[model samples]
Target: MAEFLLEALSEEIPARMQKRAAEEFSQIFTSELEKVGLAHEPANCFVTPRRIALNIDGLPLQQSTVVEERRGPRVDAPAAALDGFMRSNNISRDQIEERETKKGRFYFVKIETKGKLTKDVLPAIIETSLKKFAWPKSMRWGSNSFRWVRPLHSILAVFEAEVLHGELDLGHDKLVFTNMTRGHRCCGAEKISVDNFAGYQDQLRKARVIIDRNERKRLIQEEAKKLADAKKLRLREDEALLEEVAGLVEWPNILMGSIDEEFMEVPSEALISAMRSHQKYFSLETLDGSLAPYFITVSNMPSDSTRDATIVVGNAKVLRARLSDARFFWDQDLKSKLDERVLALSKINFFDKLGSLGDKSERLQKLVPTICEFIGLDNVNGAVKAARLAKADLSTMMVSEFPELQGVMGGYYASADGELPEVCRAISGHYAPLGPTDACPSEPLTITISIADKIDTLVGFFAINEKPTGSKDPFALRRAALGIIRTILENKLRIPLKQLISKSLDEYPHLTDSNELLDFINERLKVYLRASGVQPDLIAANFEAGKEDDLYRLIMRVKALEELLASDDGANL
Candidate 1:
């Protein structure tokens, strides 16, 4: 048994690419080893912006020898066939063995393959991996003609004390592999040579680099939490964003940066979104649970600077500038009525084949009321009005510049337009549950409009033959369909999906054939049901989009049926 460490050190890999690349390296290498009759107990992969590392445990010292049996020509076969079999097996007639069988005795060839040393196999595996490794995006750098996620920095392929030197000619003008690695750009103790994994990790830590992303994340969270506690503030935990920020840097430094007093007047949601999206910063809240006047930013440098005050001031200046832009857009958008711009959406293309957003918005107005009644909404008028004005925000400059804030801006504009409170809320609420855990709108009016808007998008897109197909959902129909399923089941609404989808598309004469569209939704439902722990086949057996009017009831039945299907009685059926 022996331990192996394989590291592919490269220039800064994109944070989004690091995790995937690490997983691929482990999966591909494991499968390749198995293919060559070499097996290890378990292999672990770790990744950061600088390198991908794999640690294999209990790897065999050498591949095991194998005996192979090859069938040859029958005992009484032609001379030519016998000669060919002898040549194929590398044996003459004297070496061949005759075996008795039901169809008379047959000639057979037995061969044994000698296993190669672990040292010899490692190099070939490493070279093959380098040549065949897959990446979503790669590029060639300098004149070397070597392509990678970034320019190749070093190849630290080591097994115990010996580094595996394969046939790969990967070296840049200044970088080459010899078990040497540089530490953190700001804090570590310069270049050092590592004989093993421990030496490698210790040397990197001294050089200011945290080679493990998970450790860097822990340090970040601990330091950030400490800062928040000192100020008696609560850290707003954005775990997804935190993981992303963790991958963005090798050394994490946490600091609390103040916001401009004037800029604090900006809505907290807008301010937080701007900070998180643009600066990769986390927002802080006061002890009383209100958005605090300060936020936290993680810097990729040591926190030993005497100019920390100056750094916060400079960061505050940048935050003020960004927040001012949002405030200006918000103020300007509300100075005039949004209704005046509803007519302008006709100029903006929603889809070339399906017509304009204005056309879709118009259809939504008619469909919303029917959906509201189906969802048992008491405020049908409010929901309908909200749906009508939802896309109206698309014509605003704020939404034009920041397209991600479409629903958000609609809520703001609706409030500014002096619409009823429920109507204003519904405007933004319709897009809720964007993700699995994102909140579903509890208000009936909001739920109705949300269902109508999503259904319209799914149906309209399907009508135009743009349905999602296996691993290719450019239109995000799957998400739209899942949103419908979750909203109906969560809200306990009784709207029949097929009826609603058909009625939504009924206005478009070109969508007369709704069969495929119906099937698309049904397929999407099966996916959703299966994901939510329902047996797919059992769900299919009991519930379908075609016959079911009440989606919520159908989901309940599907779940119950799936439970039975997993039981002994249903398994027999």
Candidate 2:
């Protein structure tokens, strides 16, 4: 048994591309090894901005020995046919043996070949691996026209203790590999030799670089949590932001910084979005759930700057400028009439085949009353008014500048428009339960508007044959579907999903083939049910056996069916 370590060091790979590159590299290598009869256990791949590394253990040092069998022409065939068979198998007539078959007699050649050493086979594998490497976007650099995600800086192709030297010299100007790598770009700045994977990781760690992303994320979380606790504040839990930042740096140093008093006056959401989207800083919130005055920033460099003042002042200045622009947009948006802007949405195209935002808004205005009655909303007019204004924010300059603030700005704009308090609240609440565990709007008016808004999106997209394709949901239809599913189930709404989807589609006569869309919606429901630990067969059985308009009733049936399966004498047969 032997181990292999392959590393491709390049300029910073995009965070999104790193994971796939690592995964595909290992898979391709393992498959190539297996093709040559080399058996292996699981291999691991790790990725960072500057490099991708793979290590495989329990791999055979040589291909397993095997017998090769070749079938030839029949025993009584013509001389030419026998000669052709002998040529194909590279054997003489004397080497061939006759074998009896049901149809006729055939000649056979058997040969045993010695296992090839891993050392001799790996260079060809490495060369092929480089050629077959898939990059989301690659570029040609230097005299050679070979394209790569970035300029291929170095290729540390080693097998066990040997360097596996080859003709293709891989490196940048004056940067050559002699079985060596550099440590922390900041700390050592000098190249060091490594004989194995353990030496590489240890040396890199000593130089201030952490190879594992999970380790960096853990350090950031722990240090940020400590800083938040010390400040008597809470870090806004943004796992997506945390993961992105974790991948962006080789070394992470978490630092606490305070926002200016004026900037803190900006709405917490806008402030947080500004900090997160631009600066990659995590916002802290006060115990009362208001945006705290402080934020946490992670640096790739060690906290060794004089008094750590360089990082602090630089980040604070950047954050202030970002927050200033946010405040400007907020004030500018508030001064305009939100209701007047709702009329302007008529110009903004929702889709060419479909109508504009205004048309969609009008549809919601009509649909909301019906949905409100179905949901038993106490204030029918309020729900309809909120639905009409909710999408109006899409036309506002503030939302245009900060797309994350669409629903948020709607709530504020509705309030400024002197609408009912409940209506204004519903503007924000209409997009509730964006994810499975995200909060669902329980308020009657908000629930009505929420359902009307989401159902419209689902029907509109599915009607256009733009349904999501296996994790490639560019239009976010999956999220919208999940939101609708969560809203209906959590609110315990008795309204039929299919009926609402059908009713919404009926309004858009241009959108034909709606029955297909309805079927897709039902499929999406099964996904949600399976995720909630419901038996997939039970969901399929219920969908096949029952015809219910209410989503909650369908889900309750699936849940009851699952419970029945869990009992002592439950019959699956």
Candidate 3:
């Protein structure tokens, strides 16, 4: 047994693509090795901005030899058939033996196959894997017809104590595999040689590169928190941001920078969104849970007093510029009321076939009143008001710049415009519970508007025959359906989904009956219930009982069924 290591060094890969690419590399290599009768103990994959590395432990030095039996024609068959079988098996008639079976006697040849060295098999595997590598988006560089996420640089393949040298034909050029690789592009660009996984990782670390992405993320989090603690601030946790930052650097140097006092007056969400989305900086919060005047950034180089100071200053300046733009949008948007922005939505297309967002908003306004009535809520006026302005922020300058703040900015604008409190809350909460685990709105007005908004989208899309199929939900209708079901079940609302969907379809003149839309929502409900650990049969039984539209009651019945099955009498059934 021996260790094997392979590294493909290239230009900086996109942060989103690094993890998936590393996974592909590991899966393809290990599965191919196993298919060739070369079993390995386990494989570890590591990725950084500039490299994807795989290390396999307990790999056999060579494949095991095996004996195979080749069945031939019947012993009494024609001479032509016998000759063809013998020729195909590369054995003469003298080498064949007669075998008796239940059907008839047959001729068989026993052949012994010699095993090949692991190094010899790996070249073909590596070449085929590279040629078949799939990237979400690939580009051809120079004159090469070979497509990669970026330009091909170098490949390092080592087995035991020897370099497995081979050439990868990239159509226009050939990349020669060797036992050499370079480290951090800035801090260490010199060639480094290694014969094993342990030596490769050690040398890379000494050259100012951390090839392990998880290690980089841990260091960033721990060191950033330490810096925040020293300044009497807390790091606002963002795992997505942390992963992205880790993928953007080989060597992470956590540096704390301060936001200007003037820009801190903007909404914390806006400021945080600006820094995190545009600048890739992590926000800090004070002891009182308010936005702190500081943010943390990770640099891709080793830390030095002078260099760190310059990096911090440069980052702070960039953040200030981004926040200044955010502030300007904030001040300008406040001068106009959210209701005034409603007219501007006509210019923004929601979807090519679904009409404008302004049209959707109008439909929502009309649908909320009926939704409130069905749910037995008396706040129809407030629900209708919220529906009218929920998407008004889509036209706001702040939301135009930061599209993630759509509903959030509308709430701010509504509050500033002196709208009713329930109205403002409803607008803000309409898009809540976006995912399975996100919070669901419980207030009457918010629930009414939220369900109304989602129903309009579902019915409109289904009416146009644009429903999600398989794994391709271009409009995220599945998420919208899931959100609706979660809100209804969590809030214990007895509103009939089918009835509301029918009313929603009525509001759209061209839309037909919403039976198909109702079925779609039910499918999403089953998925949601199954994911929540409910048995599939329980959900099926509940749906079969004709309580699918009333999600709360259906879930209650499911719980009862689960309990009944847990008891003695029902267990027998």
TM-score of each: 0.91, 0.92, 0.97
lDDT of 1 at 182: 66
**Model 3 bad stretches (over 4 Å):** none
Could you arrange the candidates by lDDT from highest to lowest?
A: 3, 2, 1
lDDT of 2 by residue, 1-573 (tens): 887777777778887677778889888988888888888779888887788887877777788778888888888889999888778767777888999999899988887688988878877787677778878899867766666799876677667777876534333333233466665666756876776788888888888878887888899999999999998999889998888888788888899888989976667778888898889999898899988889999987877767467888889998889888989988888878888888899899988677999988988888877786677766877777787788999987768877888888788778777888888788988888777678988888888888788788878887777878877998887777777777778778888666677778877878765546556666788888787777667888899975656778877887787788788767643
Best by lDDT: 3
Global lDDT of each model? 0.78, 0.80, 0.88
lDDT of 1 by residue, 1-573 (tens): 787877777778888888888888888888888888887878888887777888786778888998899888788988999998887778867778999999898998778888987867887787667767878999987777666888776777777667665646654443333566667655663667776777777777777778788888888888888998998999998897788888888878788888877767666777787888877888898878789888888777777677666677778788888888878987888787877778888998988677898888888888887887686667767766777788888998777767778877788777777888888888877887788788888888778778888888877787677877678988777777778878877878788666787788886767765446656666667777777776666776775434565667777787787678789998898
Q: Highest TM-score: give the candidate number.
A: 3
TM-score result, candidate 1: 0.91
The total of clashing pairs for model 1 equals 5
The clash count of every prediction, one per candidate, is 5, 2, 0
- Rank the candidate models, highest TM-score first: 3, 2, 1
Q: How many clashing pairs in candidate 2?
A: 2
Tell me how candidate 3 scores on lDDT: 0.88
